[model samples]
Target: MASDAPAGEVSLLDSYSPDRPPVTAMRIDFSKTPLAPHYSPYFAMVIDSLLTPAECAAVIASAGSNWRDLKKGDSWRECEQILSVSPDWAKALSERLAPHLPDEIKVLKKGDVLSEHIAGPSNLRASQGTSKTVWRLRGADERLSFLRYRPGHHFKPHCDALYSPGDKEKSFLTCQIYLSDMPEGQQGGEGSGGETRFWPSRTGMGRQSKKSGGVEEDEQHTENESFLNIEPKIGRALVFQQRMLWHSGQEVKRGEKFTVRLDLMYNHHFEKPSK
Candidate 1:
């Protein structure tokens, strides 16, 4: 795949034109069939058939009353309140996922930042590694749980760690696993709207200066950041390095819209292990 395209392409959309054949036609399953290194460091994968219907139901059930707030005109205030149910569900998910989580996994949380409605589980922490945390809800950091949106409830171009305060630098990777499928007939079509976008992180993009240090000042240029949008897939997780990557959720158009989104942080000593 890399050889087919010239080097230094800035955006995925750059390599294709209306007259050219679709890029999907060039795809090769190098992982299953022996081939050269085609996967880019920023590549994302979709484990389409990972979760069963029963598991999906259990996850939705764990959401409780929070699932009721997803709709056309819901305010952020209402959505935030609805998101409060996550820690409770996350606790239940943690307990259920205990046996499957790696022995080194640990769930971490910050008491001051979390809402009173969702204080979260006390004894969870994740192991430090280069790879992103596993999608298993157990042994995951609950304080990092948050509800996201796009126009309608849109989140403009921005990265996750940039908004977080404590240990933000320690968060080497960020993960958002989809809890439900995309709504039908939405703009952008089947996988449009509600897409999670990732843009190449320019050098010195997120660096801060002590001379003029304030959250608002630091965030002044965030809107101009570039990114690539990814459509959500149920049971599939999106993970990537946080340093030079910009990402956000696209707006939803029609039909029901809801997702269970969380962030996974890691320390400097972490390394991703082989699958």
Candidate 2:
């Protein structure tokens, strides 16, 4: 979790190769968009066709043979494919998404004395030299993680951890781009079980009411409460606040599931500059 770049500056993808192909950006109107059915928005939304079918195919092929299996007990499991791409991918995405994102992502001052009850102790820090109450998207993380889930592969309910480097920068949002749909003619057709589902926070401070003993008891927790499910669709990107949302990659029972995950980094600044 290194600082990608200074605020308002572009980060060079140092770990990525510069030979990767370019990605196209889509214009979306997220204003007035509501969270799926009943959950609060929490800066979460889906953008369909963010990448073309050809682009998705190309991205999948780019992974080549780098696929590696990751399993940490029963809580997490997936096949990961890592790709190093030029900074253009993150630059284009950050630019297109900036206008739609909130103006200021808040962060506390570096030495501010706050109680332990604060939700994000690490995220509340300000820049090293100045009092910072605002943060802005610096760039996308260059290390792209392309995940593949075969039938029966799944991740249990969990919240995405933040990537904070030093006191100046951190990752606040995640962009999960679906690369391929379930193969045709499966049990429930293309969009069957491989879904990025979201549950309301269990601490009673979030949108929906708190629920207990559900996720811990049942691994998938499909029977406990109504959740927002974003099915696998080629080129669809699910972007949400990483800290506030509790999500899981439901078990894939049909065909293979392909997705590219990107972390969007934000950097705190000393002052709120005039727009």
Candidate 3:
């Protein structure tokens, strides 16, 4: 895979326009905070017009059929609409844009969720000259998959990790490439509810307080944590250290919300042992 862009070209303060959103700096000061040791200064970017209108529409249509609905008051119960586009389309788009997608697109079903997808050639190509400087750290021979969400569907706050014993440490980075236009009439205001939010990890509260002060502690943690709520933009992708961050998809209250999320994770080729 290619390396990151040069320092001068990858500005932490510089902003892009029209096709790209203005770049913003995230606070790297983790020392003074009370967060868990895993917390890191993760980075992300938003790029507009990543795909053509026809491509976006095709992906959205495919996703619309696979949506799984959720019930009210559920913690992390949300509906997900998914579709594994043809390999040709996947490769074409990946080649033209995200070269990091795997050559094979695997369609997942109930009870078959895995940690991450391998980055394809398209992914590597897009990262070649980008600001985020860690794309080359990805492993080779990894698989890649895309996730979709529709209106009224919400993925509650949760970290993307292996729920099983052996596979927990294999997950590396959680990358999401936004595949739809941020609808104008959504929730937060004009472009409201379809925001993707990342909550800071919570750590160090007394063990006794953990059970007895559950609600209170959660509220307190929420207040102390720093978060990034990104507005959707076609072709824009965000990558972050998974184990160190807690993230979720905010509800899609208004307008049609469609997003194609991809994950780049480690496989058996992982170099270091899991902590």
Off by over 4 Å in 3: 1-40, 61-64, 70-75, 83-151, 162-171, 185-191, 203-226, 267-275
**How displaced is residue 223 in candidate 3, in Å?**
6.5
Total residue pair clashes for candidate 2: 2
**lDDT by residue for model 2 over 88-129, one digit each (tens)?**
556655554454444433332333332111125555443445
The prediction achieving the highest lDDT against the true structure is 2
> Which order, best to worst by TM-score?
2, 3, 1
Q: Give the per-residue lDDT of model 3 (tens digit) for 37-108.
A: 444333333444455555556544543353454332334336553435333333433343334333222211
lDDT of 3 at 152: 68
List candidate 1 segments past 4 Å from native: 1-45, 66-139, 144-151, 162-170, 186-192, 202-227, 265-275
* Native-referenced Cα lDDT, model 3: 0.42
Q: What is the TM-score of each candidate against the true structure?
A: 0.47, 0.67, 0.52
lDDT of 1 by residue, 11-100 (tens): 222122444332121111223321112223232333332333445555544434433333321231123213432444444444433343
State each model's CA lDDT, in order.
0.39, 0.59, 0.42
